[model samples]
Target: MTSMIQELTVSHNPFDMTPTMNYSNTTDSSFTNNSSTITNNQSYDGVDDFLLPWWQQTVFFLALIAILIIASGGNLIVIWIVLAHKRMRTVTNYFLVNLAIADFLISVLNMPFTFLFLLYQNWWFGTFFCKFSCFISPCTISVSVLTFMAIAIDRYMAILYPLRPRIPRRHVIAAIAVIWIISIALSLPNLIFFTTVEQSGVTLCTYTWSLDKDLAYNYLLLILNYIFPLLTLTITYSRVGIELWGSQAIGEETSVQHDRVKSKRKVVKMMIVVVIIFAVCWLPMHLYFLLSNHHPAVTKLDYIQQIYIVFFLMAMSNSMYNPIIYCWMNSRFREGFIRVFCWCPCRPCKKFRSKLRFRRTLFPTSVNAMSEKYSERNGSLMHTMTEYVDPDVNGPRRVSNNRNIVRKSDDYL
Candidate 1:
């Protein structure tokens, strides 16, 4: 039974938890019948013997610790900026908040366990966490990818139809909700399949599936989480780039229009870089899994374990990089980070408050200026319409009323 279980419980290479091994053909009936004893003996042989040297392990541990700190801290700042500031709550920023939430969860919940697993090469956190961490690893990644896709689509609509009404806040909320729902649904299979098994006395957490089922799941993850999102982002951003740079003026160019276009282009460029970075980071990990599963010989290479660690860490580092990118590309986010982090004296706060008051004071004057300009454009028509009216046509009172109405309109402006 133990031999059979070992043969049946091949690891699926999703999270890179399971070690690669070659099974030897055994015909001894005594070994087959008492396989449990052999397993126990192997377990007692010590799994820690495979661990890296002390200094190498320390370096790996420190790297993971740094990644955890940066990823969690950066993503928290992103969430805070979006939630605390009214100006930061635009549609794109809303999607960014969702992305940050996913990254935050991954940083806090997923990375530490993964670090331990990489260090120890065994499941030490027990069964519940074994299942949970496996499930959420894919879930958070799916959410991030879907959010990126949604942002790409949003940008496409905004650039392609500049005059169209903006997506309502409710709809944006609904879309975010849907992205999580889909992500959870996609991750349900992992929860069902992941289990802890003791082999050769060493406890391992891995997904146990029939060969066909494993292949199907891998292909599904590759398509849904990776390939499809990458293609959609690439196509959508390409169209957005063409639309942004292809046409000059559908009508007369104003300073406002030029500035708006420039701002949109800047934002689009930043998001494009974001999408590209995500793709580049995760692509190697996905390819590594694909190659390892299809051509098992690749896993036998001298540095395969080290290479796997590098690729896996690269993928995990995706969550850490986005906040840095945002601070680099967006001035508002930079200012928000500075305000949140910097300890400023009273003078700067006073200056900021005075600037706000000045803008408030100018608001009504700006509205009046717009109204007067609009009224001036139609002044000739208004005069023509009122010119032919006689004082006695209706009554002298009616002519007086018309003049009063005109006076009031001018006064309101």
Candidate 2:
């Protein structure tokens, strides 16, 4: 999740607006016609002026297309896993699935046109697609980030206080709906401020905002992209760390506590790593934009300013990397991944199936099959390893034995 992603290439103007020079003779003695009526044409050649050298624009768009394809494919796999596996379904993972869905839509919507725009720096898809695509990209990114924040909070609670009741499925659905509604609300600015303008006979997709709205736009982006969400992460993780590690009872255990300690530590470490990666990838981009807004003079540092665009794109890509981390670092996810990939041996699969069948027969109808399966498998393991008896046993054998003992006591009396 924390690896260095490839950066976006530098953007250059696709159209040539440079002036052409015309040469003329100063004096001609033999010519009867007037010698000097030269017209200056400022108009640029459509084909010649926009003639892109072979290696630059086309190839770059192709690379973007490749990334888009990978992102779309990978997100689809995640969605499939979440949907097909009942074990993968949870209030938290439900949100994650929604996030992936949004991100997949964003990748599908933005990347193709992004390539088109890069190739010509023009909007041939008309004003509607341009506005729609622009709105969708940020909307998805917002959903992705906010969902991550929610997940972090969920994880913190799960780890720090495992005894508490989980957030319900209905609220999770409601929360995801609200997130989308808010994301769409934030995206409305694009619908209002984006337009297609004709310049030098070429249509360009660009932001069209009044000066007052530009400031508002920058402020809104800053808040939504960085400030508010970082605050959420900071507060949640801080409390989580305190509750996990600050308890005296856990710290005081000394004899045979290594396994519990290590397991606890692993969970904490993974969350910490996730938080750090999110911070590292996004903080710089937000700071760059925030500073740039405050001091327009910072634009004079062209190279430094260019770095911001690269970082922002990198941050966007971070949305997809969380699932990879979950799969790698979390044992439950690793098992799910193995099952999905069909890496488990046939023997294990058969045994697992037998266990499932046993659970279904034992539990009958009242309990959920999945919960019954989990309980049966674990209880079977414990039963195999240790001796246990039912406290409520009142079978005929026990009743007969009790009667015999009482009769013998009466005979002795």
Candidate 3:
């Protein structure tokens, strides 16, 4: 949001004039009241481009709404998948929960106000939210990228030093706290700069910082929020991938070793795909902000508002795609999503089994028969959900299902 946006307001209501284009592509940039000149009974050329052609508003309105639903909904499901299920909880997945929380917060707080502000060319949400949204958006963004770094590093450590102990739950919680603290500290400038401005009758919410400060901060965000984290993820994941994949041949490895390697590979692949999506989705917006801040006059070109709309959409849409990625790339997450949204049960649904067991328990004469039934049904449902610590080491816990399928530390991927 270090980008600056100022709209030139004219004092005229000429009949047959179309709605004015009051938007600037300066991120954290919107139709703002920063311009000094005001003309009476005069009109500006191409100033009415933002809100004209009613169909553009209709389409974009719907698109933003869709993004709101999917990003928030999918992230909520992802949170549930990790927290509500025992098997999904792991050292890396704790970071994922933080990531999902940050993304979900963006979907709720940023999307609606952004759309309304863009559509009306005014700050309709008021002063408190104006600053809060600006503050929270960058804060959450910082949290997500940092959490990505955490996940990558955790996976790297778990795979590279399989015998070493992993981070405990308490330490991971402390790390999440530290991530938030750092994010808020970085975002203080946004809170300071963001305010509601009054011009003519229009109200705008934006930062009014000096040009040098804005550019410095934008560049800082570029490095910290986008570039630095992108590099960190790439390097870490590349190394992790090498460690997981560069191993013994099929004929030489035992079944247990093979299964562990395969699980780690699947989880690593999913994370790599997620990081790539974040990079690709945010590139255009980052470039636009960089260019606009560097060359202020570029904001005044014909059709520039439309271009910003496209770039911003691409960036904001980043939140919505992650849930789909989780479902598509990982079977466990897919099962969780299905179990939640579709009301379909995971394989070996226990609802019927529990009912049958209760019925058998009601008849004392069938005690031996109940034991036989339980044996035939395999391990009890409790065993399916239980996670046991490996006697060999203190890394991630080993999980057993009804069929006694054992997964190493990386299965939470």
Candidate 4:
């Protein structure tokens, strides 16, 4: 057996299998065989050697399926709530709608392929998916980060300068368009640099770049997607926290002012939690890539492949988390999600209608009582009284004597 193995090696290499063997003058056949042998050996190095047991594979599969369901369902709920309900269409929520769209695309387009790639260690999909996935997966993530940044800035402006006029709806739309454009442009290089290459008997979808260029690109992504956004969120939220919670005096603490402050603080806290969760979920994946690229020897370790899979799943879970955060932290979003999913049956609808009816019935009585009181006091009827009902929330506001003046509700804020 030893002699046969030696003969096979000699036939493949045609030279002594020593470090000192010079290959410049070797025949093409021998060089090809040697290269093929090395490639075949490397193909089984990482995932194959540490392949999980059947039960573990089953658990992993179930986990990925759960992620798929949660990511898709949760993000779709966010999108629907924002789009279907006028109450949810604030400037900040519009950015969130953009975020939901990005996460939805990631959940639908990227997660399944990623699961297959990790499980099989090869790209079974054709070249089209190879390039398409490479371009879109990162693009969605970039959009998410950019959208988060936009939300942070929007919050910063609203909290820091409450007196200034809010950003216009058109400007918010333009910002969203710019975010998508920038995200696509950032991912364009993936279409050029990524392709499917055959290794051993399997086709692997990967980047085709020089080592230096690959490293540079990876670092660029780390900075743009992770580090810079994290810093921006940290600083902006820190300032927002101070503004909301710090020693700002409220000289006249009316119920309306108190509710406004509480609402602002709640929003700030929810956004801060979102930023922290994003950083936590994504940090491991970025660190894994950085370490693998900078220290190739780590890839040869026994459990390195498993660690990489865990890191990837952690990163992908980010797509599922924001909707959960929204549900848990914001009552309005929670109510919206409940309404979207019909989780509460007819209770919310009945309550909403009852409130509207109550307000409608009460407003006219109050107005009539006030008019009678005014007539008794002033000996004249007030002809300019106007009752304004907020169409979105179905709440009746106070009647005013100002003509042609429309009152906007602050419920969205």
Each prediction's total of clashing residue pairs, residues at least 3 apart in sequence or on different chains, is 2, 0, 5, 0
TM-score for each prediction?
Answer: 0.77, 0.63, 0.75, 0.76
The true-versus-predicted C-alpha distance at residue 244 of model 3, in Å, is 2.0
Query: What's the best-to-worst order under TM-score?
Result: 1, 4, 3, 2
lDDT of 3: 0.64
Stretches of candidate 4 exceeding 4 Å from the true structure: 1-50, 343-413
RMSD to the hidden true structure, all candidates = 11.6, 15.9, 10.6, 10.2
The clash number for model 3 is 5
Give a tens-digit lDDT track for model 3, residues 278-353. Answer: 8898887666555554455555566654565666667778899889988897766776776665444544443322
Best by lDDT: 3
Clashing pairs in 3: 20-48, 21-47, 21-48, 21-49, 21-50
lDDT of 2 by residue, 1-413 (tens): 43322111111111000001112122332211111111213333342333346665455556555557656765776677667755446665587688779768866777566545544545687889767877776687678778868777776765565546767778888988888988888878776767666655456666666546645665676677667887888888778667556654423332212333344455556655755666676665556555654554443343432243245345545555665766666554554555555654662532233210102112122324212221121122111111111111100011121122211000000
- What stretches of model 2 exceed 4 Å from their correct place? 1-63, 160-163, 250-275, 283-288, 291-313, 335-413
How much is 171 displaced in model 1, in angstroms? 1.3
Instruction: Supply the TM-score for candidate 2.
Output: 0.63
- Please report, in order, the local distance difference test score of every candidate based on alpha carbons: 0.63, 0.51, 0.64, 0.62
Candidate 4 clashes: the total is 0
Cα deviation of 262, candidate 2, in Å: 5.9
- Candidate 3 residue 310 C-alpha distance from true site, Å: 1.5
* Residue-level error in angstroms, candidate 4, position 214: 1.3
User: Which runs in model 3 stand beyond 4 Å of their true positions?
Assistant: 1-42, 45-49, 249-251, 295-297, 343-411
C-alpha positional error of residue 105 in candidate 3 after TM-score superposition, expressed in Å: 0.6
